[model samples]
Target chain A: AQSVTQPDIHITVSEGASLELRCNYSYGATPYLFWYVQSPGQGLQLLLKYFSGDTLVQGIKGFEAEFKRSQSSFNLRKPSVHWSDAAEYFCAVAANSGYALNFGKGTSLLVTP
Target chain B: DVKVTQSSRYLVKRTREKVFLECVQDMDHENMFWYRQDPGLGLRLIYFSYDVKMKEKGDIPEGYSVSREKKERFSLILESASTNQTSMYLCASRRQGTTNEKLFFGSGTQLSVL
Candidate 1:
């Protein structure tokens, strides 16, 4: 079974600062990784996903994640944070068949001015 | 833009009541999924339908069931609502054969069982 682990439960960053959220997964084969963001009272939206080729994948709202197979880690990062970037972030992993997405507990991001 | 819409944004149901949560996708996707979101447990998949009238149990499917009579609509039913079932329920749809493709999600239905 594929499982995802997000180390950070909550993170606080000031506007214009760089941010990184850690994610690690346990899968047998090459896994499909995804990042999702959920604002208050909203559903999860895809940020970006890594399927095969690219080690680094870019997502919406200037967010990106790198897939490191050796370390079993796919961490989400943003060069600069904005006030509107405050939301809950989840890292999910699916098998090769994409049966169902296994999600992390999610990291709640708090952007402060 | 493609979208998934849930019938209710918030619902209040009493214990032992049968609760129905409806989800419809405009993109005509073949796969629809229902998930419940709790504070620390994350999103746990309850059920999914790969095609019309075909359903499958997800990781957590004990108390919930699903119906997909039409191509674009999927509904989740709670046989007997319990306080533990009171949480945010999310509906998602994805295109067929594209497992890596992004899933479109509805705003979600927040159900409260008292």
Candidate 2:
């Protein structure tokens, strides 16, 4: 079975400040990791994903995440956040070659201008 | 670009009524999925179809059923609408054998049961 854990339930950051959201996973084999963002009344949008190769992956909207195999973590980071960055973010994981993803409870980000 | 569209953006249904949520994808993807999003539960998969007329139950499929009569369409059915079933339902699609492929999602349908 695959599972994803996001420790932070909520995070607040000032606009133009750096931000980091933590995520961890439990899977038997090499996992396929993903980050998704959801705005109010909107469906989830893929932020970034990690399958193989590079340990760091860049996503849309100036977001990026580092995949650390030893830590079992794939944390999302942004150099600077904007007011529009406020939304619910989810970290998901799936087993190698498996299509279904197990998602974390989610972390709600509040950006203050 | 992959375009996934849902039938309704907002819906209101009475308790005990059967509700159907429709989803269509233009990418001709072989895999389609239905999930419900709650306040703190993130997204829980309700059902998925990998081919026409083939359905698979996901983690939470107790009160929901699915139909896929065509490759481009997938429908989610709530046997009987209930207050507890009110949620934001999301539909997603992905191509088969593309294990690393990202899912494309619809805007979502917010269903309210009265």
Over B1-114, each residue of candidate 1 has an lDDT whose tens digit, in order, gives 888999999999999999999999999899999999999778988998888999999899998888899999999999999999999999999988888998888989999999
* Residues A6-112, model 2: lDDT tens digits: 99999999999999999999976679999999887666888999999999999999999999988999999999999999999999987866477778999999999
Model 1: per-residue Cα lDDT at residue B33: 93
For model 2 chain A, the run of ten residues with the poorest summed lDDT: A94-103
What's the distance in Å from true for residue B82, model 2? 1.6
Question: Candidate 1 — number of clashing residue pairs?
Answer: 0
Write the residue-wise lDDT of candidate 2 on B10-95 in tens digits. 99999999999999999988989998988889888899887899898999999889999999999999999889999999999888
TM-score for each prediction? 0.97, 0.95
DockQ for each model: 0.71, 0.66
Q: Report the Cα interface RMSD of each model, rounded to 1 decimal.
A: 1.2, 1.4
